[model samples]
Target: MNGAFSLLIPVYRGDDPAHFAKAFSSSVGEQTVKPAQVVLVQDGPVGDVLAAAIDHAVESSPVPVTRHRIEDNVGLARALDVGLTLCEHEIVARMDADDISLPERFARQLPVVEGGVDLVGTGMFEFLDDGGAIVARRVPRTGHDEISRYARFHDPFSHPTVMYRRSAVQRAGGYQPLGLMEDYWLFARMIDAGASVENIPDPLVMYRVGAGAYARRGGQAQWRSELELQRALRRIRFTSRWEYVRNVSVRGVYRFVPEGVRKIAYRRLIAKG
Candidate 1:
């Protein structure tokens, strides 16, 4: 891809501008490859302070920066669709408004672009409720065949950790509007399109599983979201059982095991192949 990597952060409901700016600086400032641009696509109305923070971030980025604010509140998948149209680079990586990308996130993935992989994801450090403490690290590794196998059963790439080729994403027809698991839908498509994917073996993103960020909003809406997710996965030809049980168990842990540790165990299985 030309000009290093392009980072896209989709904002909705006025995400913390200061945090976003810190994330931008953290991502680009410590990287050697240097990003081509950081595109801030606001999916919804952000507060004035956050808006100013975004502008400041755009202006201050050592690399190029672009900002696009939508008139209405578009969901994450559609927001990503809009941003993809504006990306000039062949490689596009994703960032969430509230999370932080590690210093080496970009530099580690940029050189691997030409290796014929359709997408590459990396390990993650999920933070605690306080954000000061890290709960666990999730690093996934598997050969091409095993990653594809895992994708059939579950999404192998953590959404924020992915660096995707524009053409590969386009060929998969881009993100689906699945509300709850849009990234998972897209990964299933990518695997069908002959896309090879694997996660770099180290924590490349610091994710604050912050309050009110979906998981915490666990009420009627969350339940319905999972119901919708089942239908969405079925559309891609995965068996219904795959969607509800195995996939669910494999994602973020279930019953008792911590999510990050579960991923490490799965990677061990993949590596044995």
Candidate 2:
């Protein structure tokens, strides 16, 4: 109801301890409009060092911290599916363990949430290393109509920069374990379920990228995932036959392309420098 919201962050064994600390500090410790609670989800067993970092971050957080641990590592989508249940507020803000949430992220997003938008997401800057120079800015469509139109082709929201109402997410069937296409699939369903969504074009989170991010993005596994996603979209009536064909033709080939070529396509065609 009010601007109060819960910050949800999922951590896994693969996360860097140092990066997690910085992420926590930026998302919770230094927020201009603080969250009422922080829901930290440990997807699986982490190293002792990482566990200690989590403890330290929790102890240092300004708001009440609640942690949930899963017995096995279930990947991001499932982790978030479980994490969403632990959130205690109507509004929930998502943050990644390796990304930096700008100081005004909450200040800029909470008002939109309070104003009755079911979900709101913002653009993000991608960087290679810890707080390094930005390489690209991925900005999504800002209005509801544009977002709905864009969702037919690609994800209209940046996952880490989203703040959404819990009820709306649940009403849309929550998150599914859909490999790399989880966020895209979930958002499409949410839109179909009639959830009002909007995106702020300004970059609010600094997304961290690995050296091999582009190279790792494409492969047989990703190709299969993309194919399944397109089919799911068609099955759900989110994409017409023609749209599905177009998506498969365009997005599917990118998955199996050479690393250098894929990188060029992503940087030059998808992301804005």
lDDT of 1 at 221: 52
Q: What is the lDDT of candidate 1?
A: 0.73
**lDDT for each residue of candidate 1 in 13-104, tens digit (9 for 90 to 100):** 65766677767777777666667887878887878888888778777778887788899997888999989988878888888876778776
Which run of 10 residues does model 1 get worst, by summed lDDT?
250-259
For lDDT, the strongest prediction is 2
lDDT of each: 0.73, 0.91
Clashes of each: 0, 0
User: Which regions of candidate 2 are displaced past 4 Å?
Assistant: none
RMSD value for candidate 2: 1.1
